[model samples]
Target: MPAITAENPLALPRVAASPDRAAARPVLAVTTAPSGLEGEGFPVRRAFAGITYDYLDPFIMMDQMGEVDYEAGEPKGTPWHPHRGFETVTYIIDGTFVHQDSHGGGGIITDGDTQWMTAGSGLLHIESPPEELVMSGGLFHGLQLWVNLPARDKMIVPKYQDIRGGTVKLLASQDGGGLLRLIAGDLGGHAGPGATHTPITMIHASVSPGAEVTLPWRADFNALAYGLAGSGSAGAERRPFRMGQSVVFGDGESLTIRADAAQDSRSANFEVVLLGGLPIREPMAHYGPFVMNSHAELAQAFDDFQAGRLGTIPAGAA
Candidate 1:
């Protein structure tokens, strides 16, 4: 739960949005994420499961990777894999991970850090718990979001960005009841660090008990708020939501969230990841790790990857 914090939220820049504002958005849908196993047996909850792409255009999928506390020698990780035509944003809320890719991009992803990898053409990569964590065991919680590339930039180039938690812009609610971490994109004319090929806004907010957080949102971008911790309600409609749930918002200029008066010991407040992205509206042909525009492109990607055209494993590495 240590994904950036402030001793006094009131000291941070504030974003003003009133609950009674005429622009308050309404909740269109509330869905519970289904849990499953992923990448060498790590537990995951598919945040976009059962949600239509129309509501998530410019974004492919999202996985909430673990809130698990593993015992020694029990941690798991993903083997080498390939991806192309999109970007993968791996954000660690707790714990650490080491990632390596064929393009020579490698680093330790620590708590409250983000690894933004753009697999424009194609590349092979791996994500694993650090050896120390695997040996000693500890808490691991994170999220991996797949952002789709438009057809034009689908083959531009491959790149990576390491965004540290401290570098993100922190914002507070007008009443100081909520703390917001701006990871990527723009809010209230303030921009985040991670630059995206697509237009989108990524934020992590913690709302105090019985507190309300109202945020001004871009009217053109589709809005979403995924519950990461505690119980709360979303929208002016007041649909109740809790941990591991995703809320799809209808047209609006602002979002409203209220935390319950009482919360479990798991967290002190209602935590949520707010995402808003302009719809790409392009035909999407996706399979496995490749997201292309058509079946022919998909076949070509497979052929390219099989022939090692994507990339090779680093020397002396698995």
Candidate 2:
């Protein structure tokens, strides 16, 4: 099979939920994009971090990284860093990212690939564009999400899941008008590739103009949708949203997205990312890259990193 690329979109037929579970969910709130800022070394727009939202529960932060084109030899990407007590999900829509971590984990995530890293106790890592990409220059677009672990599992061993785009289960719209790629958790009888410490669902969906899709969602889980490209109405409220908006959903068993039929040809294909997870309602004591339940634990995390307790990537390994 050919590599999945943005120009050659993927499509999965949408499977309808049972009639009894098809109640329409409405938009609870629409979050505007925050000011773009330089993170580590690249331009990023934060969608929801603990600082901006009252409670995103299990989710701590979401960063939309470059959709910007770069000329050859341009500076790009994040250097080595430390993280603890959470999982980082990197979904690449375009470009390539080479990742190396203290746990001896390393790989390249290209278009349609996802790197789900569980920084259970702690881990040092680096994510940057491949040298070739940096040398030749190209477009880069992706999202990095930080997911909090429940208190009990916070100190578990770190792990990594590098999932290929083609391996993700795809669900098609009944009318053949859209596709949904399930990266984690289950959707429409399809199970995702990544196993999680917490229950969560990550879906990337693309809907052609005039397509309508309804997906069954766990009513108790906190759910939100990020408009990736084009424009569409979400839920029964028909709240109109364009690219770059984040829409939080109200409590209901089902969620929907309907692409605008009148969109210009260039913008007719609407793309979105839907995320939902059960809340880990414990206290969160966070310090920079570390997240723990108490100040003491947070302090220990830093001390450990300083003492080289978290493993290190060998020189030249990255």
Candidate 3:
């Protein structure tokens, strides 16, 4: 029960939904990704085409995965793009990437690193392969998420957070192998180093087979879980979850997960990224990589980018 005061716009305290708990609804209405789509003379890698869990409010979209298999050498990656009125958070698990932004703040995010970027107001950025890594048929893997900015902060200056593995703390069950890595927000009375201007929480949890873990949730918020590896059951009715799948919990008490562990086989080893937050009930008009409240605003962002008014590359343009 972390306390989230009204003044703390970024704090997402847990509040239990009512007892009646609306009928259990599908956490993810639909899942889609940008995979198999041709991009700049390359065949999109299968790993990069992630199944989305688009249930959280104020959060417009999500890409639950990305992978770089050097063996394929199919230049599987996303080219540079522009964005506005939102934030992008990339969490690396098994690979690496180079992030360059219009603000001039960019860097290489190795495995176990979390890169949180705020494309406030407007910014042009790209996440592509580094010749050295891509040439080796580098085995790259990670996730990219999009968080919406409130109307007021939509035009603020862009910012970035590169949280390395050592900097992020982990909590595990005393009796079970279930473990939780706090990427952002607070959990078990502990706060992560990944600072955020928005009220959001993202946690990466790995549960051992036959282990059950319960996570607290806020009544006023929406929750989603992306299953990376392994299979398990979650949410009401104990729905089945498999790799490349996601589960969204309707307004409820909390999330209870149980991973399978059959003898003589790799215990149900699974990686799940859980996210939740309060929503911004504003209109959303999106074009390309930019998401604004109106079509007019989206148009203006493109115009500004072409006009070169975004200011000479900021201090750390990677």
Find the candidate with the highest lDDT and give its number: 1
lDDT of 1 by residue, 35-137 (tens): 9999899999999998999999988999999899999999999999999999999999999999999989899988899999999999999999988999999
- Candidate closer to the true structure by TM-score (higher is better), 2 or 3: 2
In model 3, which residue pairs have backbone atoms overlapping below 3 Å?
27-248, 70-137, 103-314, 104-316, 104-317, 105-316
> What tens-digit string does per-residue lDDT give for candidate 2 at 79-160?
7889999999999888999998888888999988999999998899988888999899988888899999999999899999
Candidate 1 residue-wise lDDT at 149 = 97
Deviating ranges (above 4 Å) for candidate 1: 18-22
Candidate 3, residue 80: the lDDT equals 60
Q: Candidate 3: where is the Cα deviation over 4 Å?
A: 1-35, 38-54, 72-76, 262-268, 311-318
What TM-score against the true fold does each predicted structure earn?
0.98, 0.91, 0.81
Q: What TM-score, to 2 decimals, does candidate 2 have?
A: 0.91
Better by TM-score, candidate 3 or 1: 1
User: Each candidate: what lDDT?
Assistant: 0.92, 0.81, 0.66
RMSD of each: 1.3, 2.8, 7.2
